[model samples]
Structures are given as C-alpha cells and as structure tokens.
Target: MITLDHNTAQRIVDRAMQVIGHSVNVMTPDGVIIASGDPLRVGELHHGARHVALRGESLAVDASNAEQFTGVRHGVNVPITVGQHIVAVVGISGEPAKVLQFADLVKVTAELMLEQTALLELGQHRRRQTEDTLLALINGRAVPQSWLDRIGFDLAQPRLALIIEPAQLPGPDDFVILLMRQLELSDKSLLLAQVAPQRLLVLAPIKPASTTALRSMTEQALSLLQSSLSANVHMAVVIAAGQYIEGSLQGCYESALATMASGRRESPHSSVHCYSDDPVTILWESLRPSWQQQELLRPLQTLRAHPRHLLYVRTLQAFFDANGDVKQCAAVLHLHRNTVRYRLKGVEQLTGLSPFRLPELLHLYLALKSDDLSTKQ
Candidate 1:
C-alpha cells in the first residue's frame, strides 16, 4: 500500500543521515514529510519530493531554481523505489551540487531499509502461520496440505511433544525465540510453537534414533533453559515430554498435557515430568474409554454423593499424593493424624475401597485421578 509509517521513515532518515552528514527528509508519495533529521521539517510539505515521487525521477534545487517551489531547499530529492513502487521520497539537504552526489546513495539506502522491513514482516507472518498450523495438528484438526507443506510438517514422521508451562515470563513470541535459541544451543532442531499464552509445544523428531535418545536431548535442552531463565528472568517453569507417535500428533500432545496436569495435581513441587514417569495414569486420564471411565468412577460414586464429598475427596487425594502416609497427608492438609485416618476410613466406607490396602489403594488412586481429569474436561 506504500504506507510509510513515521517510525520506519525516521529510521531510514537516521540511517542515511549518518553517511550523508546532512539533514535527510523522508516524505510520503503525496509529499508530506513523515520524518526528517531536522525535526521541525517533519509534517511539512516538500514540493520537490512530490514532483520526484510523482515523476519517478530525481529533482535538484539550487539558488537559481530554489524560488520555484515554496519551502523547498537546495538539495536533491529522489524516489525511494521498492520493487516497482515508489513508496517514499528521500531529500538530502545541503548545497545542490554537494547533496546531488548523495542522491542515489540516500535513495538506495532507504529502499534497502524498506526491503529489509518487508522481509522481517513476512518472516513474522510466516512464523505465526506455522504456529497456527502446529496448534491445529496438535488438536487433531485436519490441516490443509498447503499449510502442512509450507511448514514442512510430516504426519508420517514420529515426533514427541513437549509441553512447557512458564510463569512470570515474557510474552509468548519472545519466549518462543528464547526456547529456540536454547534448543539450538544443544544442536537440536527447532519445531516449536506457543500454543497458549503461558504454554509452548515443541515437536521433537524421533527419526531412526530411539525415543530415549531424543528424550535425553530434550531434557538437556530444557535443563539449559531452566538455568538460563533462573539466572536472567524471574520465572519458574514446568515441562513435560510426551511419548513418541507417528501418523498423528493429537495423542502425543494430549499425553504431554496430561503429564503436566497429572504432575501438578500429584506433585506440584516437581518442575519436570516425562510420559514415562507415569504413562499408565497419564494415558488413563486422557484415553480411557467411556465405559472404562464410568467403571472407574463407580467406586467414587457414593463418596461423591456424600454430604462431605469435597472433604472426603480432598483427604483421599492428599493421602495418595503423600504416598499413603497418614502423617504426611495430615501435615499437608493441616489436619491431625487421627483426623486424616478418620477421613480415610470415611472415604473407604463411602466408596467401598480401602485406602489402607495396596490393591484397593491403587484402585482408589486411579479412580481419584480419573475423576479429576473428568471434572476438568
């Protein structure tokens, strides 16, 4: 559209003025000065610039010809041509002959700067598109072939998903770059996106190599990220790596998400979680069949319907999270040891599953985790 914003115009003038040693003016196609080394000249009309821009040529003014235009100076005004368009005009202010020598130089400088700006804008746009495509793929949406091809996404290739949740950090765009740099520092490929404001998703390829190797590499890169963030930024992060999958990415993404969610629910102190840490629980939370989910929740039905359902559930969760330690659970819940034991007994009587027995404890734990995921969903 040939819309030269004031900031970009000022930057072009600043860059060109450094070399020309004279005031430089950047004017829009209609001859209104958008920027100039002499601030007072900004927003003033430059007749010579308008003529040069309209004619697609250069105009020189001198003492003899200076009176031809109002508020015109003795300098050369040339069109800043970008591709086939004359987006703006550059006027170097000095003696006509002296400034004439810098006419093409200033013009070329402005055009190069404009081109660089365009390239940067294009790159940012493409990066946004890539992120959108990655998000759609993770969400199991059918992406267009063109979009997949644009970002070089291959559904048939195995890739593990890594979900990153950071607190008190910079905006997603900046953090994504930081993550990219950190991964690059470890000499790993970058295929990541900011799927949410506080979350990032990285797709790590597991080609001919083993998932274990890729996981190790990811762990090292994230460790570096943790150190970097802790040293430079006031931020804390939790990262989860999902299992490797090919042909589809939804399961992998869900696995990473579930890993993070389950980790935070079960062990909030942990900063890093991998799918292998508790694949059974993670998978059960995400992929359990409706029938299976109903069956699992059946044990908790009576307890959920009880008058003190929330208390019972909270105590049971605290106990399981404490690894079946009544004292630890009591401490965590700020309850007495007997109160904790009493609550466990209440949960067992209501749910028909004993929290004290190992086998029954497993069932109760799974049921609790399943209920948690279901409620969140």
Candidate 2:
C-alpha cells in the first residue's frame, strides 16, 4: 500500500501553504495530523480531515460546524488519492468560503508528487534487479529460477556482449535515464546495466546465423546514442563487441572488456570496435602467460630506449600497415620516403630485426601488438 511518510507530508504542506497563503495540515488516513504549517497542530487529531479520509470526498468545515468535532478547524479538507487509493487528507486552514477554491489544486499537486515518488522508487527497484541479473548472467552463476523468470531472461537465447566506455557522464541516475531513453532499450532483446561509473554493459540478442544483422542493429543504436549524448555529455563514446555467448558467458564478458582495451590501443579514433575486426587481438586477449608477451616484446625493448622511440615505432607500424610499401607508408605518415626508410633502418639497427626481412618484420609486427596488449593489461 502507498502511504505518505512524514517528510513527504511536510513537503506537501509547505508547498501548499506557500501557494495558497494559508496554513496547511497533512493527516494520516486515520485522522492524526502528520504535518502542519502550525507546528502545534501536528500529532493532533484533525476531525475535518478524518471526515474526508473516511468518506473519500472533500469536506468543508465552517465556523458554525467547527464545534461539532474535536480538534476542529474552519478549513477545506480534501482527500489525496494516489493510484485509486485515498492515502491521506490535505486541509487548508482558513474560512471555508475562501480556502475551498484552492482545494482541488492542492489535492492534485499532492497526488502528482506522490505518483512521481512512486514511479522513481519503482524504477530504482527495477534497476537494481537488472544489475543483479546481468551480474549473475555475465558471471555464469546460478540465480533462482524464479529470478530468471521475473526478468524474462532466456538463457538459451544467444547474446552478443558489448562494453561501452563513455568519456564522461552526468550523475549516475541522470545518465541512466538518458541512456534508457536514447538507446530505446524498452525492447526485451536489449539489456543494459551500468557496471561502472563511466562504463555500461549491453547484452543484445542475436539470431542463430545472422551476426551481420545484429552488428547492424548495435551500430545503429550506438550511433543514435552518440548523437543524442553529444550535445549534453560526450561524442566520443567507444563501444566494443566481444564474442557471441555460445560457450562460456564469463569468457564472453572478459573478451568484450579485453576487446575494449584493444580498441583503445589499436583504433582509438573509431567509435565502435569488434573482436571480428581483428582476430589477432582476440588471440592476444586469450594469451594467459604474461611471460610470453614479455618475451615477444623483448625485441622492442632496445628500440624503446632510443630517444626517437615513438618515431621509430610509428614508422614500423605504418610500414607494416602499408604492407612494406615505402611510398605508401610515407604517404600515410606525410613524411618523405627516405625519412621513412631512415626511421625503419634505425629500428632495425636498435632491435637487430630488419624491417626489410619478411621473417624479422613479422616478429617486429607481433612485438608491436604485444607492446599494445601488455600496456593495456
């Protein structure tokens, strides 16, 4: 049952008195005054309010009739009904002829405030449940079967995991409301939760053989969200899609996070990243032994100590990206071909791995990725 608390009652009284320029009393259903502009009247039994609450109708107490009941006042007493239930009574103290005009306005205001509070509380309760359900799903833990049913979570449905990293956001509550509105997550196919202050996790349903359609849907939603948030919050929202949850759900979550980290390193300027975009990133993400990555990055250690380390590294990465095409690498970097060659030669000298040799260049390219993977970890 929805019942008015003391704080809410006092707020109603304060607001009503402010507007109507008269003392106000908020009373429980049983007639005891819970809040009053006149402090002494609080805790007193308001017979006029009791009449309205009991009858679920407005009552006007006049000076002539005030003596008919105990704790009487000449005022307009109206029932405050919330969701079809008369939860309380609001009484405005003045001559009945003068205060009766304000009765409807005050009653409506109180009911609206009560409804808003209920909706906020209901949304919070649902959000907590969603967070718990998503946590259990991603962790692959067994939740009560009833809990799963309550949330309408279909365990057998294939889902694609996505991790969203927003550059900044408003307060958590405000941002969540914004997300829900902009993302159009009312569809049961999409589930979202704020796992961190700046991070959100989404699990979207996917067809058995139509990952392309799923990606398109995700991209559209993210694009819409980015556009919607750009004016108020951020435009550079990076989202990364991990593996589909066919095997281990926990592994899917880990891969999605790892994919996000890789995206930041490999495609910082891009808004959306996917593990499908680079199979090598997935391989790097799955590499458990830190020593393997350390050993792979060993060749770059010498080159990293160089004063022009970043220049050499960029040159190597561009060279590989250009498929060893000197002109293409130079064009991409906006540097002269000879300068690109000089940087590559310096990298070869420092690392003892020639960028001109296919085998050594392959190792060097792997080392660059290793450097990225290790740094992100």
Best-fitting candidate, measured by TM-score? 2
Per-model TM-score on C-alpha atoms:
0.68, 0.73
lDDT agreement with native, every candidate: 0.78, 0.78
Give the runs in model 2 whose Cα sits over 4 Å from its true position.
39-51, 55-57, 64-68, 156-158, 168-189, 206-236, 247-249, 267-270, 286-289, 298-319, 322-365, 373-377
Pairing residues by index, what is the TM-score of model 2? 0.73
Evaluate residue 173 in candidate 2 and report its C-alpha lDDT on the 0 to 100 scale: 45
For 167-285, candidate 1 gives per-residue lDDT tens digits of: 43454556656665465455335467877767878776654446556566446545544544444333456778877665668887888888888787767777788877777788886
For model 2, what is the error of residue 40's alpha carbon versus the real structure, in angstroms, after optimal superposition? 5.0
Q: Candidate 1: global Cα-lDDT?
A: 0.78
With a 3 Å backbone cut-off (N, CA, C), the pairs that clash in candidate 2 are: none
Question: Please, what are the lDDT tens digits per residue for candidate 2 over residues 64-98?
Answer: 88788777778888998888888999988899889
Q: Which window of 10 residues has the lowest lDDT sum in candidate 2?
A: 167-176
RMSD of 1: 6.5
